[model samples]
Target: MNDDRATSTRSETPEAILHGGDLHAVSGRYPDAPQPWIDLSTGINAVPYPVPEIPPSAWQRLPAKSEERILLTAAAARYRVASRDTIVAAPGTQALLQSLPRLRPRSTVAVLAPTYEEHALCWRRCGHQVHLVDDADALAHADIAVVVNPNNPTGRLLPRDVLVRLAAAQRRRDGLLIVDEAFVDLYPANASLAADLPPATIVLRSFGKVYGLAGVRLGFAISSADIATRLRGELGPWAVSGPALAVGTAALADDAWLAQTGARLARDGQRIEALLENAGCAVIGITPLFRLIASPIAAGIADRLACHGIHVRRFPAQPTWLRFGLPSHEGDWERLAQALGSSS
Candidate 1:
């Protein structure tokens, strides 16, 4: 028998897996454009919190030694934690996450998959034994468990009680639990797990997504003082900047803006959801800025929308899935409906 004939007929692995929201790459392929494009790939707040009137001092002064620490303390109070007990400000959650595995070296870590790739990447880079699973049930026995609450890309959330239970179970095993609440500010009532964190639990929140300040690189981790101290040590001193310190504090201190923004996003998200579902697309989850849907010809749809000056996120291999952002202007939704209607 010939070796070739005895072997399998085909063998190959593709060079790339298509990710959503690569607009700059797409635009590179198609140069002719009639109008400015709308970007829905990132789940950033389109209606950002209005930056407060900052005095000249905010910009001129080298961040006061106490400013960021004060802001972290005040922000922690909003989450109902004692001052300095539950907060550690970093440039952004990404930096802190990259540093976390080192803090818990040798711990058996479990990450929720079909989620943010960064979480797993960071853990693996740190040399932790990492396992990725879809279900929260599989995390109970791990030495450390990490999840993105209202997970990115999917917008799916594990209920607060379930998270509480998972954290409690991890604590029982002398393990740690970490929740990435980057999108939870978009849904407040359903987001109490952070406020009721277990002793071994740590919750990370991003000011970027909610405040539309991604450029500023501000975020924080909430935990008990001991855990906070550990994370602080891991991230090191002056991890955040002065301008970020001022803005983050001002944003949290504004309750009026929080309520108004949350309400507006809820209404807008519902409208977007209904429009997408009506266009024969299945909406998996909803977020203030964007929502995921199943598109039979997702890549084509994204490309077509691009031709029409409308940019949306498409996961190419999974041609049946895409995500779209909500436009605050009522007219943009009408345009989206027409574009999707024509494509579908």
Candidate 2:
């Protein structure tokens, strides 16, 4: 770790800073802490959609090749896409992300700044001239553009029309566009631009967040059939496990669960947002499961909260801002509020 990077975490109170894994890491370090930790690091739903118990038959049998196809087909349908138009199935998005750059290393990639670190890391490691663009204006100049919808940490969702226009413009330059729609399932009202994106665009989604099946490790890339075919050829078969395929198919097929889970998260998120706002945190852009707040003393606040067994996430690049995720239960939030109040 860079000295500069390590310096960033020094004063942060675990409670006010909300980066993924920070809360979990802190709790792991101090297992005997009295109060339960509040993890608002990753934007995963607190009440993840319940997974139906799988049948013994599912475990006993080798997940047929068709099972994987069915999961992908269901995902395409859920996103209102054609089955053959894109490639589905990866051991989470990380597998594809790590291997993808090798396929298009010569493709000059421009990733949005303060976004997911992996976008830049993986591409750069593969010898691509990865440019990190912070401002929307800077993006207009990049040949190939990458964006994170409802960008992690900041919780900012780029306008759909704006993204579409950018993608279309990139196609004119024969440049590809990639959008990670990992959080889009949380906001269904805004359609993902991937469906209508130009032929060169690729959209990635993880079934982990919405379904709360991160352990299952299912993610897919939506692109033109040509790209999908090529990726499939490169990725080979059985990229997803039998259990993951079964669980994903089950989760996607259940519309009632999706609806109920969305509503529940929206309610819980609002309650948490109010509590944070009441504590003088400005939660301008919040999703159903997480909120991003800016505080001049965010680092100090985070460190204080950590002593009380509260953990949050913070980005070294953005010292004054923090991300907060909802706790697993309502009682967790009540305790979180008291911790924040006491620290203040």
Candidate 3:
């Protein structure tokens, strides 16, 4: 079966969201399978961090500069970033991603292929020349190099030293390096490039993925102080809501929650790998929050899962591959196992 997929801006049409998490459309197709759908399409933590109570004033007033400061400060501390001047907060990583093309003039951009398609999509839509490279080592020739560390779908993480060298080389030629570390925090100490950020390097981190608060709509862009200043101005003031700022601050500062949740995700990821393998699916790339598997009948398997009111991500680029997120509960896990057992 043809497995090509696409993403949308909220899936205005029923057929728009081909990428993942389109339960609204799934429900229409499988009305008889189940009541609630078990969506394992994205790498978001299934057991999300417990959201703390927000002050009523947070909802009553506009997000002040002081409130933003608290959120950024908390993010810096949590991420172990040394310089606050180099970090710029936004409504979400997606907002910064699309705006990045606007900040620079049309130029040649080399995106590591088969990662997150949105990187290339946003650049191409903004009139930039985009070239798809095979790996991080292929960044040598591009004017702007985009690396999705712990890459989406494949979970192929580029080495820190290699990234540092690439950034230095790119900067020498007046070029730039953009790293999407959206899924890097699960292995933060070993995987993150935030601590020793090089000049001309722009790193994007997500508050929603690890914290399981995608709706909170908060993220950060890390770069040189000048670039951060420029992005801050371009994004304008009050880019994030007061409720988002308050909630993000509490979530970022919860050390106990972070540690406990991280451990739980790691443990759960292993269970998923074993389960998938036992079901005859080859567990290929295992990330802390998700797993990418290979099945001869991946498209059919995904369709079968949908019939059971379970949704998984399928990639046409690699016809045999499917991505699955952690199932949140015992019933959901049992449902998934039964679905897999019955998969074509």
Best by lDDT: 3
lDDT of 3: 0.84
Candidate 2: where is the Cα deviation over 4 Å? 1-19, 22-24, 28-32, 56-62, 342-344
- Give the per-residue lDDT of model 1 (tens digit) for 1-344: 23342121111213243454567786766678445666666778866777777778767767776787689776876666566656888899888888777777465678886777677666665556667888899988689999898887788888888888998898889998999988887576557566667778888988888787787898888887887888888877767777788888888878788888888888888878777777778888676667988867677777777877677776643568787866757666667777778321
Per-residue alpha-carbon lDDT of model 2 for 62-125, expressed as tens digits?
A: 6778888788878877776756347667888877787677666355667887787777766656
Query: 1 or 3, which is superior by lDDT?
Result: 3
lDDT value, residue 223 of candidate 1:
84
- Model 2 RMSD vs true structure: 5.8
Model 2 Cα shift for residue 35 (angstroms):
5.5
Task: List residue ranges in candidate 3 displaced over 4 A.
Answer: 1-17, 342-344
Please give each candidate's TM-score. 0.88, 0.87, 0.93
* Predictions in order: lDDT: 0.75, 0.74, 0.84
RMSD of each: 6.2, 5.8, 5.3
**255-287 per-residue lDDT for model 3 (tens digits):** 998889888888888778777887889988878
Clashing pairs in 1: 295-320
- Against the true structure, candidate 2 reaches a TM-score of 0.87
